[model samples]
Target: MTDPNQSVLSKLPNNVIDEILIRLPFRDAVCTSILSKEWRKHWCRLPQLTLDSDFWKSKKDLTGDKRATSNFTMTIHNIITRHSGPLTKFTLCIQYWEIYPPIDNLLYFLSRNRIQHLVLKLPRQFKLPPSFFTCLHLRHLFLQNCLLLPPPDFKGFDRLIRLELHEVTISSKLLESLISNCLLLEQLVLRISDTLSDIIEINAPMLKSCDFTGDMTTICLKCVPRLTELSLRYYRKDWKEFDVANFLTSNFFESCPDHLEHLHLDYGVIAKGQEIPKKLPFDLLCVKHLCMCIYLDRDEILCPLSLIRSFPFLQYLEIQMEHNFKKNMPALECLEMEAFPDVIFEHLREVTLIEANASIREMQLIKLLLAMSPALVKMVISPHRFLGKSTIVKTLTKLAEFECAPKAEIFLKLV
Candidate 1:
C-alpha cells in the first residue's frame, strides 16, 4: 500500500514535477530519487541539467568521503543514458580535462536531444569537437578556455541570440564569419586572451550591445545599425609613439551608429604628445553617457578633451584617471592654450571624476568642466584611496573657489 503523502505527491502534474526538479541543483535533483519511485522518473525527465563544480562538491560533502567520489565521466554517461526527456539547456563547468577523452560523443548525444542553451568552461583549452556544430538549434552559448575550429562546411548558428567567449581562441576569419552568419544575434561579450593581430569585423546588424576587453589590431563596425551600447578595454602591448593618440584604433568609431547612447573605454596612453587633432571628423550627437580612462602620466589629457568636445549633447560623464608622479609636468598650466578651445556643453548635466588627487591636471580638468557645462547639474569627486585628509582639505578649499553653473552642486566623497 502506498503512503498517503506519497500518493498526493505522485499525483502532482508531470510538468509540475519536472519544473521543480530542473530548478533544483543537479545533486539535489538526483537525490530526489529517494522521495519515491515516481520522483525518480521526474528527475530523469528534467529539461535543464547543470553539472558544475558545485555539484561535485556537494556529493563529496554528502558522502563525507572525498576519496571515493564517483568518476565524473561515468556519472555523466549514466545520467544521459537513463534520461527519458529531451534536454534544452546544459552546462558543464569542470576541472581536470586532461584525464578525459574528447567530449564529441557527449556533445553528439546532446545535439540529438535538442539542446538549445550550452555553457562549457573547462580546465584547459581544447578545440571544440565537430559535434559542437551539430547542435544547430542553440540560442545562447558561452565558452571559456577553448578553441573554436568549426568544420569547413559549417554554416552558422542561425537561431543564436547571445554569444560570450572568454579566453577562447579563434582565427580572425572564423570570428568574423561566425558572427556575421548569426543573423539574429543581439548581444556579444568577448574577454579574449589571445593577442588578435588581425582586424575583427563585426557585421551583426541586429546586435544591440557589445563589451570587448582585449588587445586587437583593430576592429570595424561593418553593419551594426542597431548597436546602442559599446564598451572596450584594451591596452596595446607596445605603447611606442604613434601618429594618433588612440594607437590608430580610433577609426573603429568612424561607423558609430547614429543611435548609440552609451560608450565606455579604458584604453590608456591615448596620446604621446600634445599634437592631437583639434577636432575629429564626426560627432557622437546621440551619445548621452561617456565613460573613459585618461592618463595624466603621459600627458594623454588633450586627446580625451578633444574627443569630449565632439560629444556636443552628452549628459553624463565619468572619468577614471591614471596619474603618476612626474616632476617634469608643469604644476599650474592653464588648459586655455591655443590647442584647447572652449565650448559650452549644451546638454551636459552630471560628471564623476574618479581617482582625484589635487594634481594640477585633475584640478584644471575639474575647473574646465565647471566653466564649460552651463547646464550642469551635479559633480562628484572621489579621491584616490591613499589620498591624505590634509590633501583632501586643501583640494576642497580650492574647489570652493571654482566658477560653476548656479544650479550645479559639487560633492566630495571619500571612501
Candidate 2:
C-alpha cells in the first residue's frame, strides 16, 4: 500500500508541478497530464508551451481548415491562459508543408506574455510579423526561414543573450544596428541567403562565441573583450575577410590576447569560369586547436605551400575532398585546373582526409605527408561508401597498403 504521507508529498501543488513540466519538451510534458486527473489539469497550466510538427505529414487533399491548426491553436491558448507566471521558452517548428495559422494573432499573443526564449522555424516561405521585435523580455530568439521585417532602427531588448538567424535575408546595416544595441548578447549565428548588402557591424561587449554559415558577407564586430570561440562554415565563393586592425574585428577573435584556445574553420570554394584563383587567408597566431577544411571543385585550386605554412601553431589539420585520388593532383588543382602549392606540414599533430576516390592521388598525398610532417601522431583516411562491416574492413586494408605512412599511426576508414 502507498504511504499516505508519501502520496501527499508526491501529489504536490498544481503550480509547482506545472512549472516543472513546463521545462520539458511540449509534447512529452502534455502527455503527462494523461496519467491522472490531477496531472491532466496541471498540464494545461504549464508555463512553457512548445510545438515541433516537422514529423506531422500533411495529406495531399486536406484543406487548411480540416487540418490540426484549429485544435493546436486552442490547446496553446488554453495552456497560456491557465498559467499564472511568465513562460521560460516557447518554440514552434513546422516543416514539410505549406500550412500555417494566423501569424498576426500568434505574435500579438506572445508579445503580451513575458517570454524569455522564443523559437520560430518554418520552411522557406513563411512570413514573420514586425511586432516580434517589440518583445522586451526575450533573452534568446531563433528564427529559421521566417522572413523578418527590417527594424526601423534597433529598438529591441538589451537583455537578449543569443540570436540565431537562419535562411533569412536582412540588410547588413540594419543587422549591425541591431547587434550594436544588444549589449548583453553572446552567440550570433547567421545562416543567410544573398540579400546581404554592406557590412554587418557587431558591438556586443560580453559576446563569448560566434558561428556563421553562408557566403562571405562583410562583418564588423566591436568591443568583444572576453570572446573566445569562433566557427566559420562557408558553402560558396564569397570572400569573408577579417581586418585584424579594426576594433570590430576583435569581437569575433578577441585577438585571443590572453590565450584564445579553440578555433575552427570549415570552408569550401566553387570556382567559376575565367575567375582568378584567390589566395586563401590563414592569418592567425595563437590558435591551439585548429580545424581547416577546404573543398575544391573541378574549377577551383588550393593555396600555395607558403600560404599553408603561415599557421605556426596549428595542432590539428583536416582536409576533405570529393574526387578521385589516384591522379596525384593537388587538392587545389581541381578549383583552377592547375598545380598545387609546395607541400609543407611540419607541426601538425593530427591529420585527416575525407572522401577521396582515386587511389593514386591518395598515394601522392601520403608521400607528401611522410616527407613534410615528421611530427604527425595520427592520420586517418576515409572513403565515401556504405556497405557491410566486412566489406569496409577489406577496403580499409587495401587503401592502407596503397598509401602506407609508417611514421604515423594510420587509420583507414574504408566504408
Candidate 3:
C-alpha cells in the first residue's frame, strides 16, 4: 500500500507543479519552499517577480523595527543574485528606501536575463541608468517620477508595444527619436511633465491609441495612419496661456489620418471671458464616438452643436457639463433654429448626458439633435448627484415631452 503521508502536490509532474508555483504571489511562492523538499527552491526559478515596496512595509510593521528596511533591500539583492533562469517580467516600486546600488544591480540582472515587461516607479529625482534602455526584449514599459535621458548609442526598443511615462523629464528631440525608433509600438500614454514645454510631434505609423494630458506649446500628429483613438486633456489652470484658437484651427486634425473613430476632449476649468471658437478645423465624418467636457457660457451653448454638425456619422455621444457661475447666470438669447446647418446624423443612435441641468439652452440643443437624428435608438440622461428628486422628475418630464425621433427610447437615471 502506498504511504498515506504522500502529498497530492508531490504526485504531480514537475512541469505542472512549476506552473502552479508561478501563479502564486512572490511572497507566497517563496514561502511554499517550507512545505516539502520537492517544493524547495522551486520559486527561485520562476520567470516573473514583482518586488513592490508595500510587501516590505507590511514586514516592517510586523517586526516593529527599522532594520526591516535594510533587510528588505538585501532581500531584493539576494533574489536577483540567486535566481537561475530568465526573468520575463519584473515590477519594482521603490517607495520606502533611497538605496541605489542594489536597485542598479537588479536592473543589470534583469537586462541580462531578457526581461520582457518592466514597471518602475522610482523616487523623485532618481535617474534611470542607461542599461535600462538596452532591454531589447521589453514589450511593455512604464516609468513614473524619474528622469529619462537615453545614451548616445541608444537604439530604441524595437519590440516595445506599449510605453507610458508619467511626470518624466526628457527633451522633445530625445522623445521624438525614441518614438521613431520603436517600430512595433501600438499604444502610448504621457501624463503631466514639468520639463515638457516645447511642441510634441508624434510620428508613429503603427500606433493605435494615444492619450496625452499636459500643457504643451503645440502638439503635432504626423504619419500616424493607424491611430484610431485619441484623448487630450490640457492642464486647466494654464489654459489662458496656450493659444487655444490657433491650436484648434491650425490644421491639427487635418494632419491626422481619416480613419480616426473615437475622440475625447476636456477643456478643464475655463475662466470667464475666454472665447471658444464655434468652428472646428477638421471634419470628423468617420468618427463614431465623441465625448466633450467643457465649461461654456449660455451664449456658447452652440459650441457643442457646431461639433455635432462636423460628425455626420457619429453613433454615440457623451457630454459632461462643468459648472461655471459666470456662465450659469440666467440670460435670454433668441436661438435661430433655421440659421443652423441642416446636416443629418444618418448613423447616430445613442446619446448620454452626464450631470445634465435642465437649462433652456440645453433643452434646445437636445431638441435640435433629436429632430436631426432619424436613426436614433436611445437617449440616457443622468442628473447631477446633488439634484433633488423633484428636480430630476421635472427634467425627465421635460425630456419626455420634447419631440424626438418616432422610435427613439428615453432613459432617466438618477444619481
Highest-lDDT candidate = 1
Query: Local error of candidate 3 at 283, Å?
Result: 1.5
Report the C-alpha displacement of residue 32, candidate 1, in angstroms: 3.8
lDDT of each: 0.80, 0.61, 0.74
Please identify model 1 stretches exceeding 4 Å from their true place. Answer: 1-24, 35-38, 58-70, 95-101, 236-251, 269-271, 323-341, 355-360, 381-401, 411-415
TM-scores of all models? 0.82, 0.74, 0.85
Name the 10 consecutive residues with the lowest summed lDDT in model 1. 61-70
Error of 2 at 330 (Å): 10
Candidates ranked, most accurate by lDDT first: 1, 3, 2
- lDDT by residue (122-214, candidate 1, tens digit) is 656677899999999999999988878888899999999999998888888889999999999999998875668688999999999998877
lDDT of 2 at 398: 59
Between candidates 2 and 3, the TM-score winner: 3
Q: Least accurate stretch of 10 residues (summed lDDT) in model 2?
A: 241-250
Give the alpha carbon lDDT tens digit for every residue of 1-415 in model 2.
Answer: 8667556746797777866776776667767766665566665555677776532334531233434666656755766566555556778776444576655556666778867899987757677767676677889999887765645664867899999988875667667877788889888888865646676666778888877776534555456666667767654434533221232123444334344455666544432442332322434565656655543334333332233454566667666665533334444332221243454455677877776544444445555554566677887767556334674566566556643235578777665
The C-alpha stretches of model 2 lying farther than 4 A from their native spots are 1-25, 45-47, 54-68, 95-100, 108-113, 123-125, 150-154, 221-225, 235-267, 272-283, 296-301, 304-307, 324-346, 356-358, 387-407, 413-415
